[model samples]
Target: MIAIGIGLHNFAEGLAIGNSAAKGEISLAVLLVIGFGLHNATEGFGIVAPLAAENVRPSWSSLVLLGLIGGGPTFVGTLVGQHLVNDALSIAFLGLAAGSILYVIIELLAVARRAAMKVVTTWMLLLGLLLGFATNAVVTAAGV
Candidate 1:
């Protein structure tokens, strides 16, 4: 469920980029997509990390659902963004994404805390965040 939420948040962000690009906001769209794609690649690991830690493999159905949750938003967001590039709309969508992501992070942290695997959990979380920021920084530095 948490993975689904995170995935949905990611998908929406992708949609925003695609929609922006469709509307001729080429540079911003390209930059956003590049940054987002990098971030998303790492997010895949984040989704699997908890399962990996528990030594449990996720079922195929769950994986599919998670993919849809994470990637489906891009399609919808693109359609909407292309049709309507209102600042208010964009801000609202972004806010929703932000909120969802925060919620997932908190939930994951709570789980980690309950498990009492502080060191590994903290390291994984930091590693995920660092990887995300590093990838984005590279994209930005490349002027993409």
Candidate 2:
């Protein structure tokens, strides 16, 4: 489920990347890819958290499937975005991604509360948000 949420989010990110490139904003597109690559690294942790928290080691095959679930959409989204560029479409994807991520955050908060590390978790959450925003700042500065 976490993977699915992050996948949706990544798909939107990929859409942004593809849309930028489609419009000939090569610099912005490159910036988006760079920022998103960093973001994707963080999302890998999200996908693995349940396994780690439960002390359940995942099989290599399972890991591969989860990776595809979480990361494949970005590739698909880029393909779609390259050919179909529309503000409304992009907004729809972003909205879906936001909702999906919100659900995952809520679930993570519950998990953290169970571990009685709410304070530390809250700070970690804030740091994650800040990192995301800081990355976005770079993309925005590039005029995308």
For each candidate, the alpha-carbon lDDT, in order, equals 0.72, 0.79
Q: Give the per-residue lDDT digits (tens) of candidate 1, residues 29-137.
A: 8767766666666566657667876789989998777767666776677666777666776667667668877877787787678678899987887987897678667
Model 2 CA deviation exceeding 4 Å by range: 25-28, 137-144
Which stretch of 10 consecutive residues in model 1 shows the poorest summed lDDT?
A: 37-46
Please write out the lDDT profile of model 2 over residues 20-120, one tens digit for every residue.
78878787678768777876777777788878889999999999999999999999888877777777875675576567768878877777887789789
Model 2, position 42: C-alpha lDDT score:
73
- Candidate with the greatest TM-score versus the true structure: 2
C-alpha RMSD by candidate, in order: 3.1, 2.5
